[model samples]
Target: MKRIKLALIPYSAYALIFIVAPILLILLYSFQDSSGSFTLENYARFFDLSDPVYLKVLWRSIKLAVISTVICLILGYPMAYILSRLPARIRGTVSFLFILPMWMNFLLRTYSWMSLLERTGLINSLIGWFNGILPSALQLPTLDIMYTQWAVVLGNVYNFLPFMILPIYTVLIKIDKSLIEAAQDLGASRGRVFRKVIFPLSLSGVVSGISMTFMPAVTTFVISRLLGGGQNALIGDMIENQFKVVGDWGFGSAMSVILMVLILLTMNVIQRYESENSGGSVLM
Candidate 1:
């Protein structure tokens, strides 16, 4: 017990310096004005019903994050299922393929996406080439969706799909084969088995995946900046601008606190829902 306590000291100190300290500073700065006096004006500006620009940004962030997370779940769930069902011999290879891109620098990955999504980028250039051979009526329209909300969504889905996939896949692969076999023996159809047994058991993974994907999607400034062309500013972008460009640490910290609170609330709701659902399903 003494050794364990001593061992934890290093990690506890690391957490204090890196995590607790930063949160404390942000909390402190959040209530202070530029003059270093305490005030509620920062939060008031965020919740101002009259202006509501910041509120709109917050809404947009949630909206985009929801869309991205839903898309990931829709796409990832099936991919994870398939990966889990794959033959054990080749599963590692295929999973590696999914994980390969993540090994690259995140900035490089986003930049690569930017290149691909650009007006005259590789995708459009290929389309133009294909159009050159086709009749005028058969030519494809030039792609022009760059620097839009859709672009941001695309970036989010591309980057975060793996996060959704890996967690669900981990859970799916760990599901007991006997349960599936018993369901099969009990005359449950494939779809019914998946719906009744597989999905219920995998709820924890889905919850984790949703939390992981949604948090980053909501708070991402780089994807919005690179793909949104600064037109569709998210709460993240606003917070970044407040601190970096506007030199308003107080407002930035306030926004950060609000965003943090909103995230914590969302995660708590999800966790509570997961507990209730998982318990009920297991009981049934």
Candidate 2:
């Protein structure tokens, strides 16, 4: 009990000084006006859908996050499944390779895409070589994938793929081989086995992956800024602008609160669905 108390004391102090204090400050500021009078005007501004700019930015952020999450799942699931099936000796090395890029600064990784996607970028140069094989009119347009929604999605997927893979791989590794064999013995096809057994059993991992990828993707400013340009700016950019450009701490805090609430609501809905579906499963 004494050791536990001592351990918790440091954590409690850290939480108070870092998490709790900053959140409390934000909350306090969120309710105050420019004149320092307490008010809900900041939050009220968020619900004014008549301001198409805010609504559009919020929608774009949610859409981008959702699309990126889906892309991560589609790409990561198969990769994770293959990785899970590999020999234990190679799994660690493979996992390391997947995560090695994450050790680099995120800004550097994002910036690297610029060189690969520019008009005279590596991709465009390669395409130009191919275009020489055809008439100028018949040649395909030079790859201009930079500063588009695709760039933002690709950036998100590259950064968050590891988050999706790790969780799904962890869950897949623990899945019972005997259960899979039993399903096969019962005349289940490969698709059926995957859809009914493997997928259902992996809901916890899916939840973890989705939460990890989606939450960060929505709030990420650097990737969209560096890749999507200001044109594809998300709600994160809006909140950033409010604080940095408009010098409106109240509105920024309110935006932060709204984002927090939206994340909470999304997670709750997903958790409830996962719980319902895994109701009778022993795995969870």
Candidate 3:
């Protein structure tokens, strides 16, 4: 008991100083009025459903996060399965190659896509070259993909793909080879084996990966600002605007609190669904 308490003391202190303290400060600020009196006005502003703008922005953020999470899952699962099937000696190197982009500066990666997608950019330039061999009408239309919701989604998927891949890969690598072989020997189809055996075993990883990818994708302001343009604002952008441009720190803090609560609710619902389906057994 003493040893566990001693170990917890450091973590508790760190949490107090960093997480708890900051959250408390936000809560305090969230309840304060412009005149510095305690008030619920900040939160009440969000409850005004008549204002469609807030709901629109919030819904857009949710949609973007959901789409990105879904794409990451679809893409990551197969990649993870392929990597897990590789020989042990080459797995680490391949995994490193997969994750190497995530270690690069996020801002740099976001900006790089701007160069690739901009008008007269790499993609358009290639299209222009290909158009030389065809009638102008048959040429691909020049796209203004930048400053759009698609750009934001693209950036998000790129940024969070590694988060999704790593968790799923970790779970896949630990799957019992004998179980797969037994399923095959029992005359189960490959698809049936994957659906009945592999996917169920990887549910925990899916939950973790979806949570990691979705939470950050929704709360992210930088990618939206850089790629989606300032006009194509998300809830994160609205919170940032309140804090920085509007000078409404109290309202900003309230928005932050709301965002945190939404994320928690989403994760909890996902976990509950996963648990029910998996019969409450954790893969690990």
The C-alpha TM-scores of every prediction are: 0.94, 0.92, 0.92
Candidate 1 per-residue lDDT, tens place, 1-284, comes to 78778988899999999999999999999999999999999999999999999999999999999999999999999999999999999988999999999999887888788788789898999999999999998999888788999999999999999999999999999999999999999999999999988998998999999999999999999999988897999999999999889999999999999999999999999999999988898678
User: lDDT at 164 for candidate 2?
Assistant: 97
Worst window of 10 by summed lDDT in candidate 2: 275-284
Backbone clash pairs in model 2 (N, Cα, C under 3 Å; residues 3+ apart or in different chains), count: 0
The C-alpha RMSD of each candidate to the native structure, in angstroms, is 1.7, 2.2, 2.5
- Candidate 2 residue pairs in backbone clash: none
Against the true structure, candidate 3 has what lDDT? 0.90
Off by over 4 Å in 3: 1-11, 134-138, 280-284
At residue 149, candidate 3 shows an lDDT of 92
lDDT values, one for every candidate:
0.94, 0.91, 0.90
> Considering TM-score, which of the candidate structures 1 and 3 is the better prediction for this target?
1
Per-residue alpha-carbon lDDT of model 2 for 1-284, expressed as tens digits? 78777888888999999999998898899999999999999877887867767778899999999999999999999999999999999999998999899999999988998999999998899888989898877888887889999999999998999999999999999999999999999999999999989988998898889999999999998899999987999989988899889999999998998888899999899889778777868655
Model 2 CA lDDT for position 222: 87
lDDT of 3 by residue, 81-158 (tens): 899889999999999998888778889999999999998799999888888888877987777789999999999999
